[model samples]
Target: MPIEQGGRVSWGVDHLPYGVFSRPGQAPRVGVRYGDRVLDLAAALHDEVFAAPSLNPFMVRGRAAWQATRALLREKLTNDMAVTEAHLVPLEQVRLHLPFEVADYVDFYCSLDHASNIGRIFRPDAEPLLPNWRHLPVGYHGRSGTVVVSGTPITRPHGQLKAGVFGPCVKLDIEAELGFVVGTPSEMGAPAGAFEDHVFGVTLLNDWSARDIQAWEYVPLGPFLGKSFATSISPWITPLDALPRIPGPPQDPEPLDHLRRRADWGLDIVVEVAINGEVVSRPPYASMYWTPDQMLAHMTSNGASLRVGDLFASGTISGPRREERGSLIELTWNGNDPIKLADGQTRTFLEDGDTVTLRATAGSITLGEVSGTIR
Candidate 1:
């Protein structure tokens, strides 16, 4: 298959896509995400294990494996004879694993609206943004061990909740976010630009939070127990290249010297969250103040080392428009007013047995969705 001669066409599927595949009875092996289906690398090459020629050096290795896989699939798919009759599995039948194995996790607070909303709740007289808000992307190290696949069930995290000064606490909330999956590694102490070519895909993520715990311990440092209870990601990874290009320049204050990219960067993805079975908030990925490229470029500037599966989450995506808020907390104004669902139930936060699914569509030909039930 000759992919190089495919020309300078702008194809989203070609840019950033990966998946996991295997034959019936065999455990799923990694594959690349394609339109309406997956390109089974393991079966296409007919290898018992994941190793194959021109592919052996990259398979299951790291982002390099994904980079290699992308190159090969483009060749094979372009010619249309790489792997025949491999049983095109119904996309719904397959269980999704976290597209890449994450080595570390980082959650960033780059949304000014989220920052301002949370801040106004406490210090009404002071400004919402921190003094360092415009300097760089603010982030917190997260627990990688708790990162689960798309369909996994999430147990309500148990934590202390203090209601008032020396009062018993009780409240929990979930922060909806868009996650970034790396395709290449960056050496520590370098800059964010190093990750531009290293990034492979993006997915919807939910960063669960305990508002009660957060209100108490958040004085010097940011979230700890209030933040790290449980986190979820959609099963499929939408390649960055598959996303539609944004039309305008980056949000103002621009970015630090290290976090600059072309104006058209960032994928145009429509993101939404459904509670129980009703749709709540639908925020477009374009609403983000900072694009992933700026985020990556800023992250690496400190010379931080990243692994093949290191996940970077954009803190709750909120827009200037009221309906564009990504989380219920922001939408309801901290439960000042309750949102009425189609079923006549009210929700300030997700409840037991409540299921939340996050999904995004790049176009009719490409998309990814993930849902999980609360236990």
Candidate 2:
């Protein structure tokens, strides 16, 4: 039977984001989102690569294969809709899993506004930015093992607080961000231009934070227990080819030769961060200071190898406006000012039952949303 198209589903032919999904009795397999359905790639294309539980096996096939598969998917879905309709599984009938097996996770602080906001709030008496802020894309290796799929419950972490006291996190927060999925592997180093060759797709990310814990421990080495507890990501990975890339924000001092991009890689993704059920912030990705390509180049400039399924994210995507703040610390000014919700409640930080969701769009393409409720 032909799939009925009635109501609006943001997912269309232009946005065939890939994910791993499974029916009740079936094992997880690769599928692509089409309208409100998931087209089983293994069944539709007769390829075992899609039979794998995660996207890693297919991603290892490299750029040419990725491009060819995308083209074939478009062809089958459009011209052969009658034959392909049989393989379409209703989105609700399947459970979405992490699209790929994450090999390594790196989160970069690439937003100028977000960085300045943090500096202003924490180091109010000092200059807003660190001296080395403009020199490079400051980042920290994140715990890949803790990266979870959307809808996963995020338990508030416990750690040492100010005055050497330890307790449950009081300042639970969410960082609305964009994550880049790596498909192709590289040896010693990859240049800025090689971002397209290595990256497979993009996904929405929520870097759950324990601000109180972070404030006490992140002085010399940066975040540990405060951030590594849980990082939620959207199940669908939107192909890089599907997004619209605009010119990135200009750099004050031109980047080093290795970090200089031959082409603009800045994404025009607009991200919305919601608390409980109310939309609180709408951070603009185009306003970010460092591009993903520059981040990759800088990451690999020191001879770090890129592995298939490696994930990297653009740190909080904030803008100049107060409403554009991506994290609770900045949005609330470190709990100085509370945000009033639609239900007549004010929140300085996340409560035990609070749910945070991060949704994004690039032009007409709706990237998958990452949501988690605090437990």
Candidate 3:
């Protein structure tokens, strides 16, 4: 697509997000979003930089390559004679695929609001923040195999539940998250500052959850079948360099040097949750208590090596208000309160035919959206 008269697209030249795409009867290829158009990267770059079905190869090429690629695209879009129009395709005409392969997935419970509210529900008489909660980025390894692209329908998962119950999960829910993708692998014992060199981009993630199964199974260990069924991600990944960080929340009992981040790692993105066609919540990404960089530092503090395409997600991002809660469990107070939908439908938990969409916007550009229908 021509870089428009005003030299800005909805995604804009500043945000040349990348994704894999294909049209009817065509092989999947790499494409970069420029405004409302998708530029076939293979054709525009005049090479096979993005020939593979996934973006792993391109992503793992390191920061220099990523910067060079973005620079080239920005220059081309800025100059009128830099490229031809034939290489661009209307975004609505093509299918966007998973931008990169996921090697490992970790979900962190770092949101003070989300955790505090949940703590009250599970342990009303106890302190909201558990011991050691503020000192570390508490998280768990998730099933990477079940991660899927946007638009993929998720079947409600069945698992052992509370009160000896076992069946399709009745309390199916969604967690709005900002997922960080690793581009450069880090050696064991890399500090949190390695974030500047290793982390690649960001994607909107929907961590599908089964609250009933989780409540029952979480006695000894954390999430398993309740969360492993599926995790959906947006098709495009906005490179880290493209986003300007905003100030993050201050940590009490300051973190150690390994978890320290001098720069503001928080994002000032507007997050919203839509059910069917109506927006139910507006969760702010800036409200997150733990930054992705801190999570990375903690994940590797144990000498765990990082790999390309590894995904680390900010667990359910809930804010201080009732409407901003990311899941029905908190919004409905564990199903005790029913929320009204746009169509005048009332629901405590997701019912069959319910569609939940998680979306975010950074300034005027969309960070991309992920949605899944309960089938």
Please report the candidate that would top TM-score against the real structure: 2
lDDT of 3 by residue, 61-165 (tens): 999999998988888877843454678899889998888889999999988999999999889999988998899989999999999999999999998877877
The full ranking of all candidates by lDDT, starting with the best, is 2, 3, 1
User: Where is model 2 more than 4 Å wrong at Cα?
Assistant: 1-9, 189-193
Candidates in order have lDDT scores of 0.66, 0.91, 0.87
Clashes of each: 18, 0, 0
Residue 243 lDDT, candidate 2, scale 0-100: 94
Off by over 4 Å in 1: 1-16, 21-25, 33-37, 46-68, 71-83, 163-170, 247-251, 364-366
What tens digits encode model 2's per-residue C-alpha lDDT throughout 245-309? 99999998998888887798999999999888789999999999999999999888887889999
Q: State the lDDT of candidate 1 residue by residue for 49-159, as single tens digits.
A: 442222222323555555565666666666655353363455556654655567788899867777777777667899877787766778878888888777788777665
Task: Tell me which of candidates 1 and 3 scores higher on TM-score.
Answer: 3
Which window of 10 residues has the lowest lDDT sum in candidate 3? 1-10
Best model per lDDT: 2
Candidate 3 global lDDT: 0.87
